[model samples]
Target: MENRWFAYLIPPFIVTLLLVAGSQFVFIQNSFYQDLGLGRTGTDLTLVNYIKFFTDSFYLKTFWITIKVSAIAALLTLFLGFPIAYVVARMKSRLAMFLLAGIVVSTFVTIVIKVFGLIIIFSADGVINKTLLNLGLIERAYSIIGTQEGVVIGLMHFTIGFSVLLLYSVVVTVPPSLEYAAQIHGASRLRVYQRVIIPLCAPGFVVGGLMIFNMCMGAFTSAALLGGGRVLTLPVLVQRTVMMEVKYSTAASIAFVLLVSVILINLFSLIAIRRLRSARLVVA
Candidate 1:
């Protein structure tokens, strides 16, 4: 019975593998062709699209901007989420469950709605600007729309709940007795967190950071809405290349480059983290 139940998983797994791998192969294969405009691709395979992506300053800048925003957003999300997760995880009251449920629901909310809420709050005549103006914090109303800062904020809003959930799970895994022991040994509260909690959660942090970074990298609705068409990330560039420019081949090449870059970065990051852990073990 158990064997028969396990067998049910294989068909869906194969179907998923075929759908995902098959589509990716088809899409990436188109990158080798040249764009002839009007949604048409040249019959002859060429490296022109890739070459153009590398040579063009605009594309390079967009790629860097994407990385920068994603990295910043991921780091910020981790920082902001850690404290909330810690507090919630340590809570003895039922409120903790409520908080977690709230976070989960908010996280799953549609990005379009979230972006619009951000816009409302950050608009020139919105609550934030009005409060700042009233408090004499600024002479004029400033906007984050069309700015890199806005994009970063959008990304953070998108990923903060996930970060909290990830860190919360990590925090819970750390035995409370360890924190008590550290405190009993004359360690301060801060010291307990620094020496006991953080060290144990390092692996979780790396994994969570990378997951958030990957999400930010591929995020389209948040970037598009927050950026206001000024700040162009790789995903946005790919969309424009395909939809506006009608250059399918170039878009495919850009998409391929983005995909490869994310995979390589993640691979290198994990390898580097492993080396660091090994070094620490050797030192100990």
Candidate 2:
């Protein structure tokens, strides 16, 4: 059975493997892995760029910042999405359809559009500033633009939708009888919702959180636009290296690191999901 499954996976896997091979061809050829346009002159096999990535305070700081921002974004998505999922899951009307439509629309919207929209709203002379100034909130508008706040708000544009969809799907699988039993057993509404519901939905939350964290960790568009280019995420840094600077080998190395990190996160999440399932079965 496992062999049959492997056979089914082979075709697409082979094609993707070939593509990855092509991508690495240049890196392997150019011992030092510089830009394509730059012809190798003399020295090769140097790992200077990677050492710089590690030793340089600038790059290290940006790496830490990316981790911090992505973590916060994932947590915010969790807290903000839980209620919407519960409400929409329980609802049986056109209003639920409308909320689902909003989630669907949010997923379909382009990141660039959301970033530009936020830019206009939070710009120095934009609506937020104008409204605040008019209301005498302050002599100057508080700068939300080009900061972590801007990045978080922009990240939430997509992540909130992801959270809602994932959580909603998980909630649908939960047996309604459990909630009824809890209520009949004298549990309060809040207790039934929290104690009974949340524990059961842990797997979906783990999956969704890891996915959101991974996406935000490598985010380029939102971080660049909202952080005003000051927020240097791994993807944007990789882009700058590949596109602007033309450092292929170093970029390849960091890209490898990012891919490995994602694989490990997913692997750990799978283990956690399995453990939760096992524990639930034992309890049953």
Candidate 3:
């Protein structure tokens, strides 16, 4: 019966492999072909697209900006989410349940709506600037729109709830007795958390950070909306290349580069996490 159940999974697995891997294979092939203007592409394979990506300064800058923004956003989300998750996971109150529900509900909202909401909040005369003005923080209205800062802020908003939820489950699983024992040894609150909780929560950090970084790397809606044509993430550039410039071959190359970069980064993160886990086990 178990063998039969495994056999039942084979058909879906093969279909998924074909649909996902097959499309990526096509994209990789398209990237090798030369772009002949007017929606035409040459049949012969060439390294022109890949060479342009490496040699051109504009493409290089966009790639750097994407990586920088994603890294910063993921790190910030991890820091901000940890405390919220830690608090909520420990509390048995109705308020804790309410907050968890709110986080879960926020995740269900459409990305378009969320991006639109961010635009309104960050506009020239928006609440942030208005509040700052009232508090005498600035002489004029400040708008983060059309800047990398705005884009990062928007990306963080999208990822924070997810980070919180991911970390919450991990935090709850930590044995309370372990924490109590540390305190009984006369360790201060900060010391106990630093020495005990943080190390154990490393897995959650890796998982949550990977998800946020990956999401930010390929994000298009926030880049298009908050970037205001000023920010140039790979995803935004890919869309413009395909839709406006009609450069399918070039776009495919950019996408393939993005895919490879994300995969490589995640692999590195996994390796580092494994090493850290091993070191921690040895110390314990």
Candidate 4:
């Protein structure tokens, strides 16, 4: 307790210093050079690599795609996670533990396995295809693979479990009596959720949202395997840049920009949470 103020920020300050130094070292050493078609190191320093990224439509398109995918994934996780969290938090018993365990296990299931499962269920000549054919719902097999829909669905499956768990933990911490009081005041079940539980769980949702958003932004493996390279996200583009051109500098630049964007998103979420806390305190 003697150095309480020191205890408040010294850890994060140390971490920030180390992170900034390391990132700067990497960026400076790698970024000032040119990628001579195969990254053989050109004779002179040129800003052309960075310039190309901004000017080229292909990279610009990839940036837009990346943002779109991340936004959809974050929102999907929020909606899918909120109700599951509400139920798990309100329902007290060993069943809650069992459900929590299921979510934990589901969260770690490899994307490849998930995509394979979806293929079995959603592929051409798969269950839906066959069922629809037999029932005359559709005249032909619907191709769902290697599509944006596939990528979005896969990302939702990949992210929702952790979101549910994080929000569940926060929801369970909310005092039960508050909800009971609202109910006594004639608030409907849904109204209680909207007015009371959501605000209480806002901080946890922000944490989970940032996590999902950042992961979705850099999501390479899932989008690659599931979307089958049809989806051109920023991470996929970065990988292709490195592989096709062997251009570390260009790749590093894109990656640095991506990391900076993710940091800003997290920072914004933290500020939003603080604002929400201030509003809640004002109401109390």
**How many clashes in candidate 4?**
0
lDDT of 2 by residue, 45-107 (tens): 666556777798977887777778888998898889988998899897889989999888978
**Candidate 1 structure quality by residue, lDDT tens digits, 152-216:** 99999999999999999999988899999999999999999788888989998999999999999
Clashing pairs for model 1 are: none
Ranking by TM-score: 1, 3, 4, 2
The alpha-carbon deviation from the true structure for residue 18 of candidate 2, after best TM-score superposition, in angstroms, is 2.3
Question: Against the unseen true structure, what C-alpha lDDT does each candidate score?
Answer: 0.94, 0.77, 0.89, 0.80
Which structure among the candidates has the greatest TM-score?
1
The TM-score values for the models, in the order shown, are 0.95, 0.81, 0.93, 0.83
- Global fold similarity of model 3 (TM-score): 0.93
Which digits, one per residue and each the tens of the lDDT, describe model 4 over residues 230-280? 877778777887898688788877776777777887898787768867876
Clashing pairs in 4: none
lDDT of 3 at 102: 96
The best candidate by lDDT is: 1
Worst 10 residues of 4 by lDDT: 275-284
Candidate 4 TM-score versus the reference: 0.83
| Candidate that beats the other on TM-score, 1 or 2, i.e. the better one | 1
